[model samples]
Target: MSCSIKRTSSTSYRSGGGVCGGGSGRNSSVSCRQYASSVIGGGSYGGGACSIGYGGGMSAGSLAGGFGGGLGGGFGGGLGGGFGGGFAGGFGAGGDILLSGNEKVTMQNLNDRLAAYLDKVRRLEEENAQLEHHIREWYRKQAPSVSKDYTSYYQTIEQLQNQIISATVDNNRLLLDIDNSKMTADDFRMKYENELVIRQTVEADISGLRNLLDDLTRTRSSLESELESLKDELIALKRNHEEEMRQLQSQTGGDVSVEVNAAPGEDLTKTLNDLRNEYEQIIEKNRREVEQWYEVKIEEVNRQVTSSSQDIQTSSHQLTELRREMQNLEIELQAQLSTKNSLENSLAETESRYGCLLQQIQGQINSINSEEEWLASIRCEMESQNQEYKMLLGIKTRLEQEIAQYRALLQ
Candidate 1:
């Protein structure tokens, strides 16, 4: 069987020599070096049994060495160094410097492929940052650095929450104080009303006492007038009795008359004197008692009026104090309510701010995760391609060995 290995460089290797000779008189095929290095040709093959396809037209294959200086850097260098020198010492000793037709195209293609691979390797360099860092730190750097920092936001929120709690506590306390103050004021109002009622009653009593005093004065005056009239009547009766006694004396002066009785009924003048003294004593006693009673009533009324006045004053003072206290409590309650409203608003704003920040952080985390997954997939694909290239290189090496064995058989 005869087999041929054809390459892009217009070079060919066969599994059989031209005739029965492994080293035939076939001129070498010439090529040029264009890329960093150009090596075209596999190891030579010897003749085989049954050469059915006719002898491999043994042409002189002049494979050109290239300008590659490093190890495994040229085209097909992954196989071996100088694969063409398979027991034939390679091609013509010193070939032309220009590139042959097919070899030029092949070198150009190889160089382009190599350059593309290198570019892909350079482009595949890890551009994404490491994934092991803190998420907050990464966000701080990648996102707007001037944005409000969420790291300290936690502490600020806690402080605001604490302030809200304190304000609530204070607001509750103020409400309680307001309620208590209202109750106290209500109680004071009730007491003021009761005191007012008592004052009114006392005033009515005083008015009644004044009326009684006036009536007592009128009665005393009438009593005095009646006593004066009685005295005048007694005086007139005495004068008439004295005049009758005088006339009797004059009439008895002409003749001496004597009369005798067991009892003179009573001495008229003496009885008159006794009656006058009793009436005068009774008038005096009545006048003294009425005047004393009137004076006592006036004193009692005065004392009560003074007591009511003091009570009214006390009630007024207490009422005024309660009113002032209520005003103060109302003011305090208003202040506390305002403070509570402000704190509530601040709390709401803080909550909204932090909520937005949290959402942004979550979104960033998701994006980072996706990017890492993409990088992982790319790495996996690169590894797969590398493995495939290694496998192909192995296959090419095996094919070259088979050709060399064929050449050995021909020799």
Candidate 2:
């Protein structure tokens, strides 16, 4: 059997969050933050391995040691007080004093492997240093010092709110005025309708009076025709009496004068005169009665026509007044309708303006949500890194302890 040993000045660490590693068991997480120091080294058969991490600020440190055979070999693996040291070894079945050629070759191979591991460690150190520098730069960039000018924004918001409130109040006042105007117009319209009905009724009555006047005119014409016929009858009677008297006088002129004793000549002429006077008096009385009756009927008809004319005049005057009033009412109603239309236009503009403002506010809220999600992802990454650091520190501690025990055994 042969023996080999390995050592390190600092601890080693493996990290696995999304990283895969040995034995299919996920690698432990690691971090660069300073809290403790760990030292570790181990050797195993068939390429078994050990790892450790040193957790401390990156301070200047060094490691130096030697190994020998015999009594000097026992003193070789001692530690100095700068950083911790580590050792790893494997033993094969062989004499203690003599090394086989194969064993020498194995040792040489191990030495070469250790040299390569050291080079890799150096490269990792440089990379870690670069990462730390980048993290510091990033911390500076993301510092919470550059605050936004939210004070100005708040003032702007308050001003907008006040304007909106004022606009709303104005809109309400306009609406109230519009309602009042509409009601006034309606009242006027109703009055106009009532007056129109009255005018129509009065015109109908006037037309009725005109028909009555036509009937009276026809009656007057009939009475005048009857009076002409009576006058013609009186003329005819006087002419017939004159002709009979002439015939009687002619017959008496040829008769002989016989001395006949008569008591007295009958006064037939005087009797005839009295009878004519009585008939003329009766005819005059009847004529006066007819004239009085005609006068009375004419006066009554005139009174009815006069009353109808007065009523018609009064209705015409009222109709004129009502027409004027209706014109005024229509004008006022048109004005009110125009005012309502203007107010409706203003209301539509106000609503459109508010809708645009609401859309802008919603867009701002969406942006804030997106920023919050990005910040949360960064926080998760930082937590994962911190956990890796702790696991690496634990491994380092165990390795230091093993090295100390081995040193004691050599003594």
Q: Rate the local accuracy (lDDT) of all candidates.
A: 0.48, 0.48
State the lDDT of candidate 2 residue by residue for 1-411, as single tens digits: 011233333322222111111110111121112112111112111221222222111111111221223111001111111112133332222111223364345445534544443454455556655765776687678744564455665676678678778767876776776677667667766766776676676667657755665666666566556656655655565555556556756766776866778778766556656766676676677678877877887787788778767876777777677677767767775776676677667767766776676567657757666765765676575555444333334434544464455445334
Candidate 1 shows a clash count of 12
| 21-86 per-residue lDDT for model 1 (tens digits) | 222121112121222222323222122111111113222333344422111111111111111212
TM-score of 1: 0.41
The C-alpha RMSD in Å for every predicted model, in order, reads 15.9, 11.4
- Taking all chains together, each candidate's TM-score versus the true structure is 0.41, 0.57
User: Which residue segments of model 1 deviate by more than 4 Å?
Assistant: 1-270, 373-411
Q: How accurate is candidate 1 locally (lDDT)?
A: 0.48
